[model samples]
Target: MEHAPMSDWTTLPRAFYQRHPTVVAPELLNKLLVRDDGRAGRIVEVEAYAGSEDPAAHSYRGMTARTATMFGEAGHLYVYFSYGMHWGSNAVCGEVGQGWGVLLRALAPVHGLALIRAARPAIRRDTDLASGPGRLSQAMGITKALDGADLVRNDRGVRIACDGTAPPPEPVVGPRIGISKAVEFAWRWHVPGHAHVSGRGSRSR
Candidate 1:
């Protein structure tokens, strides 16, 4: 299927992310995150992590080598490693000096199910292909290799692009999942009724 034209990086100004975390979180759903392999994945869920005030956000500690990208220009990809076994993806937000990030929590396979399944043979169902942060990263072939990459550029072969579709209606929002801090932030956002949303309360919204 023909996808929507990609979003221009220039259009995503630094101020865009500083406005409201919650609104930006759900607005990202259904957008396409394209990889160099000619495959695209539809974002299904996201979590907002504001500046230093958000305890769960890496920027909470100020700038570190690991989080410097989150403070850079907007529209950059801030990838990190966790659990000694998985990688997580985040989108940079706010001004160059400000720290903000939008964690990509899950995805709905769009244009590369066969490739994703080949990479993850253990997945027995379509919904399982990219239903969690780690799973989505793995399925999309993302890793530390992509740390600090620009999501609005194709140089890395793993840039995020728009697929010309608006997000689902009334995305659900609740507390972020799998974190010891800022558990009450209620920043997680996802398509209200998508079967692939990760974590609990998948149906409550």
Candidate 2:
């Protein structure tokens, strides 16, 4: 079957991220994250972390080489290494010098299954392939090198784009999992009952 073309789909603008991270997180649920290698995923789960006030946020302690991306313009990548092993990726939001990040918790692969499978060979089921932040980053070939990459530019190899569709109704909102500080905030959001949504076992938000 021929897939419908994505002609009407537009890359999300930088102004779309001018809002707070919590506002951007849920709206990103049904959007598309496209990679340079022709792979794409429909965002299913995310967690928002506000700058300065959020104890769980990296920028809470102030900016450093590792967190400089989060303090830049909106619509940039904020990739980081976790536990000295896996990589987790986030989309930086809010104004310059003010920080906010939306952790990409999970996604449903919508295009280039072959590429995703190649990137994550151990995944037996497609739904499980990108069902966590680290897994989503690994499956999409996201690494520390993409830390400051622009996610909204039309000519960029990686971008947060649209597929001309709307989000599902009734997204589940919950506290961010796997973080030790600021544990009570209900910043995590996910598509209700999506098989691709990460489980409680995920190591990070």
Model 2 per-residue lDDT tens digits across residues 107-160: 998888999999999889999999999999999999987888988884347889
Could you tell me the lDDT of residue 190 within candidate 2?
Answer: 88
Candidate 2, which segments miss by more than 4 Å at Cα?
1-3, 154-156, 200-205
In lDDT terms, which candidate is top? 2
How many steric overlaps does candidate 2 have? Answer: 0
Question: Each model's TM-score?
Answer: 0.88, 0.93
Tell me the whole-model lDDT of each prediction, alpha carbons only. 0.78, 0.87
Summarize candidate 1's per-residue lDDT along 138-181 as a digit string, tens digits.
98898988888876656488766564577877777788888899
Q: State candidate 2's TM-score.
A: 0.93
What are the clash counts of all predictions, listed in order?
Answer: 3, 0
Lowest summed lDDT window (length 10), candidate 2: 1-10
